[model samples]
Target: MAHDHHEHDDSCGDECGHNHDHSHEHNPTDELVTVRDLIRYATSRFNRNKLVFGHGLQDAYDEAVYLVLHTLHLPIDRLEPFLDACIPTDERTEVLEIIHRRSDERIPAAYLTGEAWLGEFRFTVDERVIIPRSFCAEALADGLSPWIDDASQVTRALDLCTGSGCLAIVMAHCFPSAQIDAIDLSPDALEVARINVEDYGLQDSIRLIQSDVFSALKDERYDLIVSNPPYVTAASVDALPPEYLHEPAMALGAGEDGMEIVRRILRDAHQRLTPNGILLIEVGHNRAEFEAAFPALEPVWLTTTSEEEKLLLLRADQLAA
Candidate 1:
């Protein structure tokens, strides 16, 4: 499936070959289309224009349903049943407009709906933060749990650059014994993170803070410090899709070479990390650049099924020299 609407001609009408005028349409009841009916129509429009990727139409349709249901505060699983039951004409029209925007504008569903899921957690999101896509969740779920030194036990953990607080909440949930800090430079991004933390009832366990890296950390140190910082080079960012433009630039670009942020983090991480502490950072496709820049630092590359991910693990001891 393709999500590019430019693939088809606009002259084609609905299968009936009748061009229905969209103008002068005010009362949605005049168009008593069901939710399923809207979904079918949207899917057809998407398919006709080739506006999605492999599974694009399906994904877009699902996203459309989610956005529509979210607008009405309805549960996603119950959307179909509700559609089959009785959807007010106004509601159907409202949902159709959202679907049309998604299908025609090629806007990402996450941005369209202002929400996304990380693990079992749903977060309120927008262009202020990058969509939650951390492989750290894999490490947490797999119990690749970091190690702490004898002098310092794993009492607290910090998720630096905590976009949407997904990682921070997950850390709090995974390590109930430890206090979690979700720190970010952007206050706007932190707002989204705060919602997720509260939504998961991890407010007591996780604290949201606004800080540029270790600036606000002061004398604070952690047994486990993880960050999926901005590692995209300026060139790469420029080449990204239009949808990527919707994300915060501060959450994406690091520098000309993309290592500006990562290098600083690696240099200063040892100071903030307790002895034997570990720091995991996702470099995406910039792993080679990172390795080449710091040959002396032998960071462990995390293996994942995701080809685009290039996560690296570093120990505080490794930086002692």
Candidate 2:
């Protein structure tokens, strides 16, 4: 499950006769008129340039539609009604410029748009924080059922590597009575998280802290701890596409095998978890390495709509053992 880049056909430009020349810029005022025209051109341009699209949307068409609709200040979900509508010259240029930056500079759509969505929740985002994408969001939305029989019972929780504090805010919604702590090593990321927490009016329920893993939490304990830490291996991080390079590298790479931070979390988690507390962590595609690193401990893999075994749950007793 590679997360950074998606494979695209290299022969498309040759087969479709679209000029691959990077020097010649297309004049949107002359060539593009309608919203449909802009979407078509942006999608084709992105496909020809082989732009990566893992930040928020999946394929070229979806990203193009989102960008055009967003640039025009139109409703993103109702694209069919405005497809034939003519775009004003200034708005058209604005759309074209954004599309060019996306294709030419390879900036992730979230960074370009300044916001990202996880499920139905939206958060402010920029280059300071990794775009919020985690299976932990889904698990939390489901109230982490079966294991977490009652959401209100969770009086306190923690979100480690909490970039933009997206998941921590989600935790506030899921467990309304719970006090949440969100931690990240980068102060810039913490600042972004602070914005999101305030945006959601969660300043009282959610707290943002800067720390290298759990270093700053001296005697704090929690009924639940969740983390979507940096798990990309050094090799994988080095090979990521240009779009991923826009994000902070420290938020992506963990070490040679991607288990460095995971090791630190495991070593200290038991001491900070309440007797009946639970821990959930997302490792993306590094489960194999995680199992290899800790063969003795067994954790229950939680199911989510998006991926298989991307998240794991460990009980306090299991962690103690």
Candidate 3:
């Protein structure tokens, strides 16, 4: 089951590596191709192409394993038992093409597979929306028990700019009694989020509204509000990798300093939150601007395994002040 880890350069302007030069014509019995071989070849291609990996995974080895396993419909988490298994010739061709597309076209694996993971939660993602990778998901999974005085007392929750309804759905699971409202501007993104909400069978618990920020709400207040709003500056949006460009620009950019929508959120959050209600928002490397924008309001930065002090938590009193 040894695999050749040769570095493959497929950037040659023409034939895209679909046609194998050698006579290794995928005769399974003749030239055996195992899962190990696929992973090694894919890893080589990924490294050679230098594909950016920030959507759901960060390393070549894990991304390689995911592409191979996900393409073949094999178990992604448990790969040890399938390493030596031979890939069916028909399926091998598809997997090889997928890996090639990933490297040559620079398409994200999440888009290739149409799924993403958010803190042990699986979501249906597509180009209609950004791939779900949020520090907010991690904090929510921790039950927000670290900050909320009594987790059970939280009855209403809001997910602003809720892409794919991932946060709203997860909140429904964490707080069964709490009613949740998730809003977004794009009808297409809401179409995708609607599907996710139905897939999770949370239609009764999480309500989806098509709106730009708090415009769609009048007097509805929430005990807890979590948002992963568009905080990427215009400059940052221009500098983002090709994979990031695959997502909708509306989901990434806020303004020149990436705080336009956030400022509006702060403007009305004091009225939207109940007494002692909490707010959690992810700013992703915009801490400097955040600190300068509202210096008076004390923001308790929340940390996750992904980033430190990037997700901010503020109380109603501080926001009101």
Candidate 4:
């Protein structure tokens, strides 16, 4: 897939661009443009522009409300009840601008607002890291509980390429007795991770390290290792929607074949895994390529409602060669 950046010069007309004036009353401002009204309008606009794939109008509305409430630092639960709660003129203007940016420039709400929530952990986000929406969160929330027979037996866990520290935090919460090593290659990405670590009060349980894959890991071993690495191939990268443009290229593209990172992870995983260690990685629709790369290994494929995701569960004993 091609990794070229999509650029918009903001040349679209008022109806389609950011220049539309949302200030005037005569602008068809939904008579009672409550918080609900604003959300509806934003959702309609986003759906019309195809911002979300397979998501219905209601999904779009919820997402828009989510972004708006998140941008204002309000809880999502408080949104519906406060629909008619007067929004200051300045705040309304700011929100309109954000909606415009989303509709016209195609910037993702997470990137535009610089924040995202994964499970219960909310992290500071930006173009430096991809938005945290991994199915791993679901697995982790279920106690990570279903996967392990004895949580207390887990001494160490690894959140490889930790990004914004969402997985690491979730692991920390799930396995209170386990210490987590959150590793990432990019310093900028690590900065975001640090914020989340501190935010979740897991600084002591989760150790943030700057290293490329197993380089900083050295002789360290872990009972559990989880990763949601970049798996987008050159072709898939080219076909991604405009919202994907808001994410960093390095956080999405995995080279020509897209197995560059996964291959490396598989090669080095055995050395870092303890006797009964488990490795869970999200391959996200690249399962065919992954299976083709490691034909000798039979990885347990896991699925979710999201069509793009394909998680694989591997054990250290299976990797013993």
Cα RMSD to the true fold for all candidates: 8.1, 8.0, 7.3, 9.1
Selected candidate, larger lDDT, 1 vs 4: 4
* Residue-by-residue lDDT tens digits, candidate 4, 1-321: 122332433222234323445676554543323465577778888889877532111367777887676655555655445565445556666777788887889877777777777755677888877788887877766655455787787889999988888899889988899999999899988999898888888888999999888887768999999999899999999988877877888888998778889988999899989998999998888888888889999987766656654888889998987
Which model is ahead, 2 or 3, in terms of TM-score? 2
Using lDDT as the measure, name the better of candidate 2 and candidate 3.
Answer: 2
TM-score-superior candidate, 1 or 4? 4
Model 3, residue pairs in steric clash: none
Q: Which stretches in model 4 have alpha-carbon errors above 4 Å?
A: 1-32, 53-58, 71-74, 86-88, 145-147, 307-309
TM values, all candidates: 0.78, 0.90, 0.89, 0.85
Going through the candidates in the order shown, the clash numbers are 7, 0, 0, 3
- What lDDT, from 0 to 1, does candidate 4 have? 0.77
> What residue pairs are clashing in model 2?
none
Among residues 3 or more apart in sequence or in different chains, the pairs in candidate 1 whose N, CA or C atoms overlap within 3 Å are 1-52, 1-53, 2-51, 2-52, 3-51, 3-52, 4-51
Q: Is candidate 1 or candidate 3 better by lDDT?
A: 3
Q: Give the C-alpha miss distance for residue 183 in model 4, angstroms.
A: 1.0
- The lDDT of each candidate is 0.73, 0.88, 0.86, 0.77
- State residue 220's C-alpha deviation in candidate 4, in Å: 0.4
Number of the top candidate by lDDT?
2
Candidate with maximal TM-score: 2
lDDT rank, highest first? 2, 3, 4, 1
